[model samples]
Target: MKRQLVLVALTICAVLPVAQAQKVGETVATPFQGFAHSAKGSQLRDQVNDLVALVRAKRLSDAERKAIELQEKFEASFDRKMRQYSFQSKEEYLEFKQSAPEQFEWIDWGYKETLQMKAFIAADKREFPTALSILATIEKIAPASAGTAAERGYILNQLGQPENALAAYKKALSLSTRYQSQRPFQAAALRGIGFALIELSKLDEAEAVFNDSLKIEPANKVALNELAYIRDLRAKR
Candidate 1:
């Protein structure tokens, strides 16, 4: 009887692991999932278009405007994520794997920094608190981010915290977004400064800054609109 009991115990132990093998479903981030649930590339593309359309529409009421602004701000970050399974700059990136392969996760996360800044600006324009939250998140992601402080400054300026905003923008402007000259990218940093000046209610200074952005990017809609708007305001006077 003791021998029989031992056999049964061993059998039960052997089966226990299998019984416990049922993995609990991993909880996925449901962010923006309500817009569309399919993870298919085409589906996501469609959803993004829909989102852009909603953002661009001028028909929104004040409350709707606020909501759309918040959504668009969060989206700016998504534009920068260069999805890949390896580092962006192969030469500089591969050195990490050779020296510290254990720490190296082979994933190319490229250029999304600027996108985050734009997103934070969008969100903050709608709701100040949300922008603050996004800024904190950017700081955590890249402590020494070239554009992080600039983005924070923009947000603070919008929130009526001009002193803090100035500090943030100064920090950001000092940090470099180093790369080859490009219309869209070059305009971003300049635009940030221009808008920060706007927040400070320095209209003349802001107009000049926008002009700088336009010089680098003649087709930049933001700078054009802002310059035109300022001129219109002046014309009315």
Candidate 2:
């Protein structure tokens, strides 16, 4: 009986790191609202949706190609718009952004969303290095994005770097607190922290964090499943 219990506990721990990996699809399916009002934006949105469909259909190679093409197309569109403004230099563009924040806001949001989709696709393919590189670009473009931090946490967790994942998840939670638009991701960040804690053999803390996640999103299947696993493990202990 003792040996059986130990084996069961070991199995649970072995599977803990991957509890959230399958949730990546739901993250990828999240729609971008930045470009919803314009015709070009609508086209870009459809392209992103197509990419998501490909990913969901398990066509990672197609998704990767589509992601690359979308990035190039978006860059071309951005450049065309910038040319219309006749900005002489990066400094001029920065000044214009500050002077006409409203005009620049949607563009910033669209660019960030496009980069985020690319990162999500890379992550879905289990291309951690590529995903991290794309996320770095997103960080440079939008440092305050809780979504980026949450993604970093998820990738780090998959890399078996629980300590780093914990920090990234914490940063995501902090950013979510400050950014109203990011609040929706708080439950996910909490769940990430819980998963990282589990990998670190901190089950008590992990249980608490998972509970917190459940409080935010009562229907979160990941959190519910993890909480059950924790209880089963503890009972065996």
The lDDT of each candidate is: 0.43, 0.62
Can you write out model 1's per-residue Cα lDDT over 37-79, one digit (the tens) per residue? 2211222333333333333343224324443454455344343
Worst 10 residues of 2 by lDDT: 1-10
Error of 1 at 39 (Å): 24
TM-score (all chains, Cα) for each model: 0.43, 0.67
After superposing candidate 1, which stretches have Cα over 4 Å from the reference?
1-127, 144-147, 176-184, 232-237
| Decoy 1 TM-score against native | 0.43
Per-model C-alpha RMSD:
22.3, 9.8
Best by lDDT: 2
Query: How close to the true structure is residue 153 of candidate 1, measured as C-alpha lDDT?
Result: 63
